[model samples]
Target: MNKIFSLLTLLFMLIYLPSQANDFKAVYELAGRHFPWLKGKVDINPLENKKQGDAFTIEVVQNRLKIEATSTSAASRALDWYVKHYAHQSISHMGNQIKNVSKLPLTNGKISQSSFVPYRYALNYCTINYSFSFYTWEDWEKELDWMALNGVNIMLAPVGTEMVWYNTLIKLGYSDQEAKAFIPGPAYTAWWLMGNLEGWGGPISNEMMQQQVTLQKKILARMDELGIEPILQGFYGMVPHDLKKKIADADVIDQGNWVFTEFKRPGIIVPTNKQFENVADVYYDELKKLYGSDIKYFGGEPFHEGGKTAGVDVPKVAQAVQTSMQKHFPNSTWVLQGWQNNPSDKILAGLKKENTLIIELFGENTNNWERRKGYNQTSFIWSNVSNFGEKNGLYGRLQRFIDEVYRAKNSEFGSSLKGVGIIPEGINNNPLAYDLMLDLAWHAEKPNLDKWIEDYTVYRYGKRNPKVVAAWKEFIHTVYNSPVDENGKVLYQEGPSESVFCARPSLKVNPVSSWGTRKRFYDIERFKKAVAVFISASKDFKGSETFETDKVDFLRQVMSDKADLAYSNMVKAIEGKDQETIKSSSSRFIQMLKDQDELLQSNSYFTLNRWLNQATQFGKGLPDAKLAMYNAKAQITFWGPDNNPKTTLRDYAHKEWGGLLSSLYLDRWNLFVERALAGQTVPPAEFYQMEVEWSKKADLYKPAKSNKKNLARIQQDILK
Candidate 1:
């Protein structure tokens, strides 16, 4: 009996303990790095059945805490649970919600928890550029820790794809300079990977590419330590648009213009062509040499966003792409974005169903998963693109997220539902949106909103003040509310309500970005009431970073709403020929913008200086610091191909940051006011020129020197 038990223990260690992929000791070291007090006070033990799926337990034995978890990811989550439920402290993308304690709190008993799913995924390809474009190793260190604590085991880390492409292009008979031309700048890699446009933001310096490659190495090392599997950008027949100009042998299809006629999309090499597999082989070989051969997932979207597929044999091409991927990384899963008709019926018909995973993108507004019958029984993650262009506004389909997730989990195709994920185009805003969605992976049934949100508030704001808690409850039904149809699908909303303040000033301004909603969907009065209550509790959380950051965020929303009202009144006055009303309202509107800029200074995260500074800082050792700066400015303003004024994507990534609000956005609105008062048509050409000029300016555009008011005073002023 003793011999049999010992053999069973040895088998269990070999089967379930991830001592090779990631060690339990590393999780202890990670905890030590984060909280110094936890260095000698905790022990992390590995479980014996991780194949049964991820789970964790917390207990205290003779004062020292113990965490028994199936994997490093689960252990990290267990620590996070202890911190939130017992210690009453938590960390988030925004900031830490912490308070001084006499001693570390322990669980009441052996509290155990388990996840129903095997994957907890995070990030969209665009998130790499939108939120982390300028991130140094220091920034990624924190970001990875946050991800691990949140139980995200699968992440998209397609940074440094330029290096892989550069080498592949060079091997395929291109000069060094020519190869570099194919790679985009740091700010434009997302679209380049999606094959939308190539070389638009480019020719990133060779030194910068190497730095990013090294950065990715470090990123991967940390992810491995924390049990995160990275999804890399796979080669799916996309080559540089100009590649056909040089390589006349291969048949390359012209994808024509992307969003605008100015930027040409990359050409696709049909799988039937001899060079298709040849290019893919070189691409993957270069990828393996640089990044390592342990990768198990690849992300590539063919025919994404209206790319031409006329001549391509859709099914054959799909099969060829997957075959090449499998040849490179055996047993790997192909991660496809189920957006619109992508991974279409033709594409799905050719693949090995068991090895494919579709991220059901646009879950906030679309039901492509159910409509297509669980993506035709292929495994998929129920996901949401909560924000677009990293824009700021409070929005989330709170209840509908729960409803839709469970609705799918209980459906006939439930076995195909593998997990949950957040694929926001930009992930810089709305922590609750990401946190709540990710949290659902651990539960088997619908979470009690009242209980979950109350706990969320506690961890989100250290010790939650009653006023703040009450305000959040109201917030649930207001800005965070999702009006669903009888089938549990939300009414169409493309991300949050676009701020009227960010829009290029016009009497007919609907949304700041193209393809965004023209109407505000929630009750303005209820939202204001919540904000006021949130502010009332500020006195208790005076020095808290989380509280202060939220203060800036909440107040920004109020000012944006106020700006809309001011703009509307001015537009009415101008039409009625009420000269006095027009002058007063216009002047007040400009003043409101000035006040908004000042209010944004309360949080550095909400400031333009931080973004621009990161850009210039990233370019410190590079040949030209100005190029990075130009990319940063261009992304937010003109979003350029330099000379194109008719580009529809202007102000698509418009930020409501401090320095930017006062400068470029202010100047645009000021011009509109001047034109409105004079009854002159505000020339769109003139505004585009201003945007062009702003993008070209060498100045860093730091915040103005002013007597900044307290957040409370700013709130009052915004209300008035």
Candidate 2:
């Protein structure tokens, strides 16, 4: 019997060995190919499986990572350590919830430190934006794979909604010319759908619209495979301003003037109107034809962004929109955004309690979360929209703000709150913010934040020293926890609104603004010590390819801040006519720009052409004299040329840089003209030859290096 058992065990081992080897090999290849930094350094440990009927358990471990997992699960138990150690309290709380629901088991141990994950799957509003238009398929695929690995189940897939609109407009007897005007350019889809702006960058091709629909279909198909739910746009009575021309008798509420333009604002066809109902039917029918009729939820708002709702009873209008929706699709829920005093009582008063859901946006700062209680007694989800307009390299809602939201939601009012969500206008900017936000969705309770951050450092860096951990903790408390004065009101700097130009009107008056002002609120001496420690810890990692990219990005931000503070102090000294101060400030500015240039050059694919154009226009040349005047004109013409109201330091810098570029080029041009007039013969027929060459070279703007790939690899490795 003993001999027979030994033989059986040997046979079982033979069968399992290859499968384990293959899995590890595939993981290894993925890490090595995508994450070049982990080339030969990542330690891979084969998982040991224990089977019980159809279900099986797998054990995996590396330095700090000790996790137990189920065979059929999408994510591993290793993720729990990342959530518990690296994520904010709110995020960790959400992660805990996911663990309970999935019934995944975890062991107490650290994991190799790296970035969070390599990719993210983002689902913006329907009829607004799709991945293909803004990002490459390679980018999207990587993000989707990462989403799957991270256990993202429900995604807001709003592709092909444009097709629904296109078909609806065509059926309504509107010509192609009229229909094209309603659709915006590729870059402005988000704002167009939100009704904040329109037709600024477009005259979109019908082919492009169709292409978006096709791409959306593919996205939905992939999402379905990954168990992600797609949110479709529902009929909310939105109509172009030209709709009145098509239907003279149609009852429509004037939406007022278009934002950032003098054009007539689009009208909201009253859902009570028979014409409106007819249009909605055609719209839904076309959508069903494309994506099927199985969609249970529809995301559309009666008063989106800041559109007017004149000549319509708010309650009546709300009832009509819901009634029209239910007629075609029963039990359909209207997902509304609780943004800036919207979905007023009149709208919510008539809607059925069970069939409506609201996303309470801007929950981090505004008590609108508490005061409105989600438009007064409606089931809502607490969502934080971290960055606005998807600006790159910006931060998100602070850790404490997240903590407060968690505490509030779990308190007496927790019943109304369904779950937590991240609703950023753009998703590609901050990876840490995205991961941390998602982590909160599954957790039921918060963790000790200081300890959690320490764990995150270990997981991100592979090996964490006390100094590195201390630096991060200080960053969380100071820069991440700084206060802001908005419109004379003091508030915690959290969410996208706090970081962008629209959020900082005073930046024109104060160029540096609040970049490093956090030091004033904390112990500068201690913070400097922490910063020094962090810098020292990272010094040896200069060429360690295994370094976490996101951490590197964070470090860049830290260094940038130091540079900015140093420059600001020097500028003050210059004002005082102190030679020492002038030298110090100039040195700091040059060094900061140099370091930034170096960091940007690290990645070969960095593209800063667009920014360069804006910066040049704002800061360089003879044309610069006309900038302030032009800027004011542009602002009045179309909301400051960028359709943004709140001007930023960057914007000011753009103006300044444009002046500089113009002056330099013009001076060079003048010098060439002088030489030509002095009878200096050259190959070119005219003195302007040099100017042409310079123009061509200067026009080809190049951006700094980006560490996106490195960051992604680090994140994925840490999660693993």
Candidate 3:
């Protein structure tokens, strides 16, 4: 009788629980579709872990997978954990590694993991434009899947705010042209949202506005299904700079041009004014009508980067802003970016402590959490902006990421450390950094990365290759390395080390992007050796997607570094007036660029055609298709304030893609080299004209044939 009872219980456990399936249909379907092998082999049950934040337990027994999760997000993560560990697969921006598995691996015992903090956040305002500005529903579907697998519970999703503003502006008696002019182009929306610049890339069509609205609805639905929260853009006093012109009595404050003198920043209407509530009500009402009323978080800031904050009663103004936010959606949290001093003590003083959350944005560089005492003890997340302008490089201070998280949790204001985040300007690079950082959210104690990285290798490339593992270990100590002060604060550096190949030709060059550096803080020779080791394993993973993608990126990096040497040699040759040396060095530099371009062509992610083609495809059937293409080109080259060479924003979005290198960067170098060799003067400022003209040209810099067949031989040659 006892044996019969146990067998019945086992039968019940092997089958799907109806309650769990009904409650988490999204997770069930996600697993079923993403991993078909787990269709009926999976059972999800609810587990309460309120105190420990979202938690999950995986029990793979008797050739079936059973999961007990605190939330749907947790369940999704559990599915991913199973895929990576038992199934030996990985899902990342670099590539997804789900191979043909005949049978699932059974675990000897149950596996459980919980978050160290209550909230897991992701995305940056810049990430919206720099990474996902032109993303379609298909793009967003994959993105949300990646988010769920990584356990990102809350994210900044300001996709359809354009329509909200348009509606609100139209109601205020603005013309259609005037309203669309307030919005930015597709590629330049990040700065527009930030109130830095307005209407640079756009005068978008009504069709595109509707497209965003539809896309956002799908995104929000998926987020809801995955148990991820969306932080909508809120009413924070940003209005078109011509608001005074439209409404003569409007209490509009003049916001000076941002960085560049020509580009106009949106005006701010003080929340203390009667017009503030009026405008706020319309914005929030339209927001609710367009999106939904269930949103509990709002993201908007005043005087971001640079704005005239003079004579504004910041405390009262801030108090009114939060009051308006809560009044619109009672008990909603106001999300503030802890970027520089935008959220000054004056700004913090006016908010309700329990209702505000600060995203401590540059944790890798600044100890703002510590310096501000955990954002004035108002509940903050320890976050890192690892990448700026989405520039590609093998970066992320892996040790610093670990050290800072632990440091915050053990600090005096540890109680206020709510979670971890990945807020890269562009989140397309450094798979190792993102994977390690996201995994940090689930760790209760500091993981000895020496072992953690071993597991990473197995998941990353299907099976752990010794050469690849050794290369990664070397990477962890070299290019991916971070030097910090005694207090674990990083020595100041912006984003990753820049590639000099992207820079315009000069005797002395630094970073391609303004406020960035070309200097390597780590031993370059060690990094080169690591890349060689990585390339050596390419023979084993020749046809592997993840392996080949990384091979291209790693090889591209080493070649970039090699160009610096050629540049230095050429400069030295020029200084000595040695024509023979000049000819040799210049030839090598141009040849190196040609070789690098071909190598980058091996991967679509590293090709210029990919970017332009995306923009072209996105604007398909739209009225401004050609203009849209121009925005894509302009963004990567001389990012504009209307052709001002003195505007430090030029080359701020420089991309070292295959076609870009061959067409633009390399062309510029060839011109510079030719002028030098012929003893002719090279015009410095005249290049801006060439850049603008290139941006306006409606031609595709299509990816030509790459030497993919000879990739291994060429990679070996790079080391030689």
Candidate 4:
């Protein structure tokens, strides 16, 4: 009997070992694709389940990495451990590679660490449209790898939702044209999915719809293999506003337009109607046919962001939605975005407390979880949206990230807090902010900013230099620690202060966007000193990409700051009635913009050409390629339906990028300056015309990289 038991155990081991090994193949494949340097040097083994949170260990022998972890996600963290600690390399925000260590550090014994938190979530609804609307498969591969390495296990994955909507509508007897007209283009899908606006950015091509479905399968497959749970779009009774016209008997409410009247938002179907469950079944059935039924989370919001709910019974609709979701995806958690009075008391009253999760959308600015009683006793995830509209800026409430997550976990409702998340609207800037936020998931104790920044500087630039350290310290104290006015109940505000340099030339430019603030709460002079110190370190570390990027970045900030002074002079010239002064001041302002644009050309990260190019690539070799390019540019500039001449969304997604400065902003400046020089009120009509015309230009712009020697010379001049 003992021999028979041993033979049975041997058979069980043979069956289980490959499944465990397969869990890590995605991580190795990711390393092979992105970090080829660590190809044969990494080995990962699965650890048995334990009482503690997800744990990992790394033992370095010679140069090889032996990683042991509870799962594939923990193994990725272990790989990050070797890369950050043993290899002294960094894969920063926007996937910037900073490498310098020639050899991996030898370890005497295994180094082990365990996470205090179980879930690390990432992404915002706006992030889908703002940052990744144009992403292809290659882009998603790198992104999934980044999420794995950063230990993000739960992410909002709505890439192919357009196709899901299209297929479902067609199955319900709607024509192809009707389906296409209801779905928005790539850039506007987020708002459409949120029931904000529909059919604004597009009449999506059938080919593109099919392409998205195929792409999402690949994304879901890779995410599954990497141990990340994808939160897909769920059916929440939203129907196209025109569905009633098509179906004749459809029980759709006439939900009005969202923010802009020209853009019609989707209508809602009453959940009590017998047809509602039938339509929902078709939607989820179509979803499973295309994407499979292995999903663990479903995310959708009913009446999101002030949608009209006049005829709907809030709790009954909520209950019906949850019931349908559970029926389709058994035991799946419903992930809701806790933004601006969402998950209202009535809605919360209808949910199954154990199977629902709310993402506290603005943890850096508000304490919604505490104020709302842990979302009325339902589980919640603490998340920060530090950036908005993918705007260019260097700002974050750093200490808030450290304090709030810790405080929440210790609060009266701590037991209901499920995880921590980074839900930035745009994620191209503020690398350190994201790095620190993700690290909080694993750190058992509150981190000392002083010690953490010291280590960050070393890993960032591959060495510790006092000049760099001093600069970062000032950054932490000032821009990084800038205060928020929590007393004010402001919602829908634009991101961090917009750079005056990027604004349309105006003396009274209160803010760049309609809802943004122009206030600088920190000491500008100290920030300048910080920039100077970072620039001065170039002579010591010119070969470092991190240093080079920071040099261009600091110079950009210094120039942006100088714009305030330039605008002041321009206003003074107008007041004094001096044409030459006005001309000189305007000329100086334009020159400053031109000079900054040239300086920004030194780094590809700061180039507008890259953004436009990436956006255009979404429709490569397709008939709608030009239309896609037009959508890309229009979304960034005059986010339009130019039918209304008095739209307020102009410059809402403005970029401080290089090519845009030279072409778009430069043209706007020259026109504004010329009109001012001629003593005429600014021509809003002409400026709008210029913007619309610029969006139509099919000319591809690729700024040549300034030579390294020239970049070095320019860096020195900017610093001095």
Which candidate has the top score in lDDT?
A: 3
Regions of candidate 4 where Cα sits further than 4 Å from its true position: 1-19, 98-103, 260-262, 484-494, 707-720
Candidate 1 segments exceeding 4 Å error: 1-22, 100-102, 485-489, 704-711
- The C-alpha TM-scores of every prediction are 0.95, 0.68, 0.96, 0.95
Runs of candidate 3 exceeding 4 Å displacement: 1-19, 50-52, 260-262, 485-489, 708-713
C-alpha-based local distance difference test score of model 4: 0.81
Q: Residue-wise lDDT of candidate 1 within 191-231, one digit each (tens)? A: 89998888878777889898899999999998998999999
Report lDDT per candidate: 0.84, 0.51, 0.85, 0.81
In candidate 4 the C-alpha lDDT for residue 668 amounts to 79
Give a tens-digit lDDT track for model 4, residues 26-93: 87886777667778878889876477679998898787878889988988887887777656667765
| Residue 246 shift from truth in candidate 2, angstroms | 0.8
The TM-score-based order of candidates, best leading, equals 3, 1, 4, 2
Say which prediction, candidate 1 or candidate 2, comes out ahead on TM-score.
1
Ten-residue stretch with the least lDDT total in model 1: 703-712
Better of 1 and 2 by lDDT: 1
Residue 188's lDDT in candidate 4? 81
